[model samples]
Target: MTAPTLFHVAILRTLLIVAALVALESNRLEAAAPEPTQKIASAAAAFLDTLDDTQRGKVSFAFNDAAQRIRWSNLPVSMAEHRGLRMGDLKANQRDAVMNLLATTLSKMGYEKVVGIVESDEVLRKQSPKGAPPFGRDEYFISFLGKPSATEPWMIQFGGHHLALNITIAGEQGVLTPSLIAVQPAKFTLDGKTIRPMGRETDKALELVQALTDEQRKQAILGSQMRDLVLGPGHDGETIQPEGLKTSTLNEAQRKLLLELIAEWSGIIHDTAATAKLNEIKANLADTWFAWSGPLEAGKAYFRIQGPTVIIEYAPQRLGGDVTMHIHSMFRDPTNDYGKKFAGK
Candidate 1:
């Protein structure tokens, strides 16, 4: 039998959140000495115990019994209001503790992406809200992992409004790749500088598309009329036919640029885990594909990068009110998403 768990209430809750986000087997968890969820749950509980009641509630996962130790959900793309509770609403110490809890669990789960996110969070906290803060204030969500480790991939669901970062780390040497990152700024202007939330993604994608010759471009643009990013959340590697672009169609230079474009965004984690994935992508460089739709300019557009395992897509959504062109982009591995994607022959 397992040792009686030793953790505080909030920590237990948070660990459970991570556990729910991740799919795990108890037997496997026990084999990994200390256990991921148990360890993370212990750490999170310690953190919650350190918090005041108000602070605990602020950063707590707002959900019902559906909130399991490994299935707590929180990452919503739209910037909706009343995203349960928020760490932003917590006190300074409490907020720090909340973030610290996340970072610590990330490390335990063998996901290094949180290091950069942790550092970025500090900077964001200090920097004045970028213009209108991209999306609504209450558009973010938070979930934790009760137990997470390389053996069992557990994650924390936290995003919304101008944010999307679903971190899932599992297996012996798996790294943390933020599943989604999106933002819609009312307009660019951060500290007098033109600042776009995903300028890097836009510029790189545009550059790669422009690099294609007239003939090569046509080969990729299967459709003429532009619309939305066909490959949205519900459609993860759905169409088996491999529509849009193919890397083989491009010349040597164009192909290299395609790699660079995708790599640029993947570089966000800035950790060993990212490097490992990078090496794998580099090896599979040849058998990849790149596709785009709409005018090369920055209005409405859609682009996709697909490889044997890696797939990244970007598209500008309709913005009727304020944002004339919004962005929706994502990266996923066919067989490695959340380390659990089924494909029956």
Candidate 2:
């Protein structure tokens, strides 16, 4: 080609610079955009691909099937009580795929808590009451509601004895509520380390409750005992009158303690979603109430925090009058369980 004139060369340089600037702006826009849920959708698809036809049939459920969505329980699969594909039935590869799916939805801490709860069941199996059905890590089940999609609503239901995680995703938002995490032999020795899956939950609440003055404790303590969560599985969309000491009455230090307790549950979801949920709860702190039952000792008491958007309960199972070793806890959003906000329910 012939050499360009000075004017033409200047114009060409200007166009090239403009194009380079445009490309950089485009890259910046792409990076700043919110991440799509396609990663989770792809992970779910991969997990399903690992399943055989029969397993897939068992694992998948209709999204609108209210009965199936609420069919989860805190009973071991050995009891033949839950409906879904059992981890015990899966091969190593299939199990890994299922875990990969969980990693996509739960934060690193959330995923670790789940695995810890499942492993704790093995301890329960060894310490079981005579002839009390089998309990172990393999007893957990994984189920899906609707087809996984980045732009559509779907849910992942995974639970077993002492654990339930119900995660609903719609567009860019995810809700993890109406979830249960508990432990039998609430504290146990594993690999020479004492593990307490629900320890932060139990200890943190106890700290807050104990910090209250005798007068404050009187206001915070409930007259009636809470044997189980009022809004546990199958108790969807229910509301309870706010009770006990209101956050408005708490001093700044005490309010901080309460927020930390709430984080034990809300922080279980991925960081972005958890931050959003925590912000919502914090905004309504003045209207929130903390109620307590039983003794103030860790692992032995029952307590709940209720607010406009959140309800969390920690109850120790009282089978045969034995309460200290077994526990049950739930976290729920009264306004948005199962992504009701996005579903327009």
Best by the TM-score measure? 2
Instruction: Give the residue spans of candidate 1 off by over 4 A.
Output: 1-85, 98-138, 148-152, 171-178, 321-325, 341-345
lDDT of 1 by residue, 1-345 (tens): 765465666788998988976655554555664344454445556656766776555455422222332232223323234333465555566556556655554433222333323333333434436553433333345654323343444555555543455555444343333365454442344456554546656777777878877887887776755556554444644644466656777778876687777765565542455566777787776777777777777545677777777777776666534323356667677766544431111
Error of 2 at 121 (Å): 0.8
Clash counts for the predictions, in order: 21, 0
Misplaced by over 4 Å in model 2 are 1-33, 78-80, 224-226, 320-322
Residue 54 displacement (Å), model 1: 9.2
Q: Give the C-alpha lDDT of model 2.
A: 0.84
Candidate 1 vs. true structure, TM-score = 0.65
lDDT of 1: 0.54
Residues 1-345, candidate 2: write the lDDT tens digits: 988899999999999999999999866654543463667878899999998899999999988878888888776666647888988989999999999988878888888888778888898788778878779888888999888877678899999888889899876788998899887877788899988777888888888988888899999998645556777776887888877898788988999999999998998887788889999999999899999987768767778899989999988888736687788889999888887887554
